[model samples]
Target: MSQLNRVAWIVTVGSCLVAALILVLSGYTGYAGVTLAVAIAAAINLF
Candidate 1:
């Protein structure tokens, strides 16, 4: 695999995890936690 493919895989897996975390948090805390996790993950991947 190439560097871009590797990064894409990371992004895809990260997105799935973020979504699941958000969904789980949605049932308890709310959208805020999910949104925060997604934002944090996105920020991490950006750099």
Candidate 2:
């Protein structure tokens, strides 16, 4: 992949990780955390 694509993927993954961490730390668990993380990452990418 191109450098720009790689950077985008990195940002997406980083956003997902941060989202998941926030959810977990805020008392969300398991599927809820993963779903919220994916949703947050998808929203970020969409924008």
Among all candidates shown, the one with the greatest lDDT: 2
Q: How accurate locally is residue 37 in candidate 1, as Cα lDDT from 0 to 100?
A: 67
Best by TM-score: 2
Residue 35 lDDT, candidate 2, scale 0-100: 61
TM-score, candidate 1, is 0.54
Candidate 1 local lDDT, 1-47, one digit each (tens)? 57886688577657756776767766855665665566566556545
RMSD of each: 5.0, 5.6
For candidate 2, list the clashing residue pairs, or say none: none
- Those runs of model 2 whose alpha carbons end farther than 4 Å from true positions after fitting are 31-47
Q: How accurate is candidate 2 locally (lDDT)?
A: 0.69
lDDT by candidate, in order shown: 0.65, 0.69
- Stretch of 10 with least lDDT, candidate 1: 38-47
Which residue pairs clash in candidate 1? Answer: none
Please report how far candidate 1 places residue 4 from its true position, in Å. 0.5
Model 2: residue 34 alpha-carbon error in angstroms: 1.6
